[model samples]
Every structure is written in C-alpha cells, then in structure tokens.
Target: MSTHRALRATVVAVAFGATGLLGAGVASAHVTADIYGSEPQKGGSGAIVLRVPNEEADAGTTKVEIDFKPEYALSSVRYKPVPGWTAEVTKTQLPAPVKNGKNLDVTNPVTKIVFTAQPGSGIAKGDAEYQDFEITASTLPSTVDELVLPAIQTYDNGQVVSWDQVSTGGAEPEHPAPTVKLAAASAGGDDHAAMASGSGESGSGGSSGTDDTARWLGGAGLIVGALGLGVGGGAVLRSRKAGKSNA
Candidate 1:
C-alpha cells in the first residue's frame, strides 16, 4: 500500500511540473527579429527577418504592423513576397531633413510596414506556430547602434497584442519590441560593397589561411582521439591479465 501511494504521489508531482513548464513556455514566447547572415555594418544594406508566433489557443493571427521610428530615417525599404499575404509600406514626411547614408538630405522616410493575411492563410492557431516576414533595407542608419521596431499583432478573434515597450537595460519588459543591432562602420567603405568586391587579394589570402588552420586542427583532433582509445584499450587488457593471474 505504501509503495502504491508513493507511486501515485510521484505521478501527480510530474503532472504538475509538466503543466508549469508548458505555461512558462507559452508565456515567454514573443515576436523576434534576426539579421540574415552577418550583421550589417553601419551605413550599409542588410536584410532582417521578423518571426511572429501565434499564441492564442482559439484564434489565428491575421495581421501584423511594424512601426519604424523616425530618428533612424530609413528611406528605402523592400519586403520579400509571402504567399497568401499582402504587404504595404507607408512613408511619412519627416519634421526636418535628415542625412542618409549617401549624405543626402531626406524629407520623407518609410514609417511603417503592414502585412495582412488572406482568408484561411494567416498563422494557424495551436502549437505556437510561427511565420517569418523578411525585409531588406538599402541603407541602414549610420548613427544608431540598434534599431527598435515596435509591432502590433491582430488575431482573427479581434484580439490584439502590442509589443511596444522599450528596454532600458534593466529587467526585460513583458512586451519588448523587436530589435536588430548594427556593426560599426568599416573605415575603408561600406561593408556590403567590400563583400561584393571579394574584399580584394588580402582578404582572399586571409580566408585561405583560416581554412588551412581549420584542416590542421581537425587532423590533430583525430590523432588525439586515436591515442585516447589506445590508452583505454591497454588499461582494459592489463586489468584482464591481473584478474586471470589471480584466478
């Protein structure tokens, strides 16, 4: 009877623990932004992917609106085509002219991007399913180290979630905005242009050197693994010999 009681108690504890973990996972899930490939240097072009997850149990996400801050003054924005979804970009005139990457003054800049899903095509509910929306910028702002994009998610059930809280280096907010950090500008020129030009002969030589170093490290690892196996096998043989002699 005691054994059965203990088994039942263990099962109950496990069930409660699992429920708590599942709840934590759902609560922690939020929209996020990530850069494609290497981080874009300041004053260069780059691509960004926004990942949106549907968290509602009975509703599907049908629309997403991303708001761009005016201070960055992004002038050129383009989005990748997504099947079953329509994308729209809106530009607003700035209060004052701001210098872009080309050092030209811009009076108008892209202010928002909104994506709407077609019928039966939005992010499906359950299992926290997600969709990625990609966008490219021709010129990233040269001054800021990070770009914070606030977003709004609309559900088919008329539910809305606003992710607009700004982080101040303290505890994370409940609905923190998505952000992309930018690398420092290269001294020579735009990083993207350099990559396009193959970074000249010196860059090619550096890449070759790195590849050789990697090959040498791989060979050294294999040799070390073989030596370890040999030592282990010898120890096992010695133990067997001593045991047979004692018998």
Candidate 2:
C-alpha cells in the first residue's frame, strides 16, 4: 500500500485504541482527585477539586494529605472548607531553593474536620464518607510540560490510600498521580503538530500514548506528501510553458 494509505490506517488504529482505553476508566483505588477547573500552569490561577471515595468498603475516611511536588514551586495555596472537620495547611522545606524562598510544604490538608454519620451521629464515627475540596493557587511552573500531584487518603483507623502512579503511554494512568496537565504552548495558543498528535505521558507502563504518536505521524506524512505533489505539478507545468515559448 502507498505511504499515504499506511498513514491513514495507523491513525485509525491509534484513535480506536485511545477511545477504548479512555472508556475503560481503569481507576485504581477509592481515594482519588481529579483536576477539574484550572490546569496546572506556572503563575496561572485556577481551581482544583479532590474526589475522595470510601475505598475500605467497611471503614470510612477520616483524614487526607496532599503532597505537593516541590519542582512546581507552588507558594500560595488555599483549601475549601468542609463541615464537621477542621482543615490545616502545612508546608515542608524543599531540598532545592524555590522561586519564593525556603522549603515547600508537601501536604496541604484540606479537611481535618471529622464527619458525624446518620446512624452513628454524635455517638460513633461516620461510615461510607466521601468529600471534595476546591483549591486555588498560583506560581506553578510554566517551563515544564506537565505537573504531577500524588495524594494520600487516610481511614478512621489509620489506613492510608496513596494514588501515586505515572504512565508512559498516552493513556491516563490508573489511579493516576493527580496532574495539572499543561499544553506545550501557552493557553489559547496553537501547539506543534507533534504535541497536538496526542502523545500524552501515561502514569503506567502502557504503550497507549506511543501508539497514538504513530497514528499522528502517519497523518502528518500524508499531508506533507500531498503538499509536495502539488509543488511538483506546478513545477512541471511551468517547464512545459517555457519549452513551448522557446520553440
């Protein structure tokens, strides 16, 4: 088959794979956070929501700790308030000096406030609890391609849920490390064809993203070939006209 046809086939295959994997929603554990509002950009202001699910089935959640990746150099961060629980924002010193100053506080605890369930209200701790937190922050890294945030979920008894995994494939990681996905270009800007081709880094050892890259490359090659053909045809027409004039 022609190169163009091959490229087309590759694109179709890649798209099919991406769709299937994305639809699977291979989530890992109960405690999880999805970056909704603002993307993680350096010096950009946005909001993020944390989705905490009851993983233990029997035991309910009591605490959660969000560890900030120091490389992002996040200085200012605030959490939304949750009822029945007191929240605390803590900071840790980064090994390297950040843009602002000292160590970066790792875990920004949104809700320390305990919950009182219906059956166990005021008497026993709650059961099957789920909560979310909205956070607004600035001073994220613009240079880096993307940002990663690993979260920990704590149960009433002291069990913790750590959803910290990074993927190499284009597919979203199962229990993916919470990430502030950044575009190669600035927001509202055009991206390179390669970056736009959907070669997103996966949180696991999957080839999903790599497969996507192959598809993109195929499509790109076809377009390039078409443009080349047009140029060549124009050159041939011009040569014929020159020969007739010389005769």
Candidate 3:
C-alpha cells in the first residue's frame, strides 16, 4: 500500500488500542484538564491546560471555569490570552493559610478561573474543535499527594455541565476531578546538587511542559487518526471498483 495508506492503518490500530484500554466511553468524556507535567515537584511551578470540548451536536462551548481546591494555595497564577475569548480570575480568603514546599505561605487562595467564548468565535461541536486554555501555576502545595480540581463547562444554549467528582481507589467516578500528584523530594543534597549541575531550572521547566503537552494531545490525536483511516478505506474501495470495471 501507499505511504498514506500505511499511515492511516497505523492510526486506526493505535486508536483501537486506546479504546480497549480506556473502554468505549473514553471517546465521550467531558472536558478535562491536562497539566503540562504529570508530577509537579513540591513548591515548584508548572504549565497547565484545561481542554474544553463541546459535546452538543449543534451547540458550541461558550464558557469554561476551573475551581482550585481550597486547601491548596497557589502563590502565583498567570493566564495566557486566547483570541476570541475572555478570562476572569476570582479570589477568596482561605479559611486558613496554606503552605508551600519551601515553607512559604499564602493567605488568599485563587478560587475560580473562568473563560468565556466571544460570540461567533468559539469552538463548535460539529467542527470537532476543542480549546486548551494555558496557565502557569507556582508555589504548589507540598502537603498533599494529589490536587483535585473541579471544572464547569457551559454550552452555547446555556446548558451547564460539571465535572466535580473525586476519584477514589475503587470504581471510577462518573466525573473525576482533574488530579495531579506531587513528586517526592530529592533524597540527598548530593543528588540534588548533581541534578542542579546537569541542567538549569529553565531547561527542566521546558522539558516538563513538552512532556505534558504530549500526554494531553495523545488521546485527541487518536480521533484525527480514526478519521484518516475512514477516508483511506473509502479510497481503497473506490479504486477496487474502478479496476473491476476496466477488467
């Protein structure tokens, strides 16, 4: 077969593997967050992506909101501008102060971050379009093994969906909150110094972001691959019919 045909076959095969692993409902899950790195170092900063995908057959996703767990206080939060969308950040006094890895504390916790699609500009469900809102969060909580973040999605028709369920070790929840586990601290000063010597902090940050993006895109990529496979199959059938007519 041609190079394109082979590529299509590969894509379809990979998608099949994912389906088997994640179950049939994997393709229809609600909007989810994809943190740039799987395990954020305690007291460090990292990139994050909240992927909002519209599930409505005819409506577009009009609004997205993420609520950080109240117990974990982020020292710094930065949002990137998405053209044709507006972002809002809400802050509230924490019931109690939160601590970071370096023993620093934050009094006010960032409560909610909302992103709204401008009219005639947001992603349409029919177009298979999804938006990834990027942000950088710093001074992560050191105490928790995992951070559970809940999100709300709004459609063009004003329908709202909430993905707020927390996953325990048992059966998966209907809607699991976006969770990021914290990596263990370095064992000793020697290893820490060696790590520091090998690369600058910026280098480490860049690598983490790239890895996170790859993880987030992997599932979405399968959808594109499946479509390519369908087109390739159609082409093969057409070619076969043409050859039979000529015979």
* lDDT of each residue in 12-37, candidate 1, tens digit only: 56555545533432333788887534
Q: Which of the two candidates, 1 or 3, achieves a greater TM-score against the reference?
A: 1
> Per-residue lDDT for 111-201 in model 2, tens only?
1222222322211234344566555444455556665667766665666667678768898666667666654335553211111111121
The TM-score measured for candidate 2 stands at: 0.49
Q: Please give the ranking of all candidate structures by lDDT, highest first, separated by commas.
A: 1, 3, 2
- The C-alpha stretches of model 3 lying farther than 4 A from their native spots are 1-28, 36-38, 187-247
Residue 60's lDDT within candidate 3 is 81
* lDDT scores of the candidates, listed in order: 0.73, 0.50, 0.67
Worst 10 residues of 2 by lDDT: 191-200
Error of 2 at 19 (Å): 23
TM-score of each: 0.66, 0.49, 0.64
Worst 10 residues of 3 by lDDT: 189-198
For model 1, where is the 10-residue window of minimal lDDT? Answer: 195-204
TM-score of 3: 0.64
Better of 2 and 3 by TM-score: 3
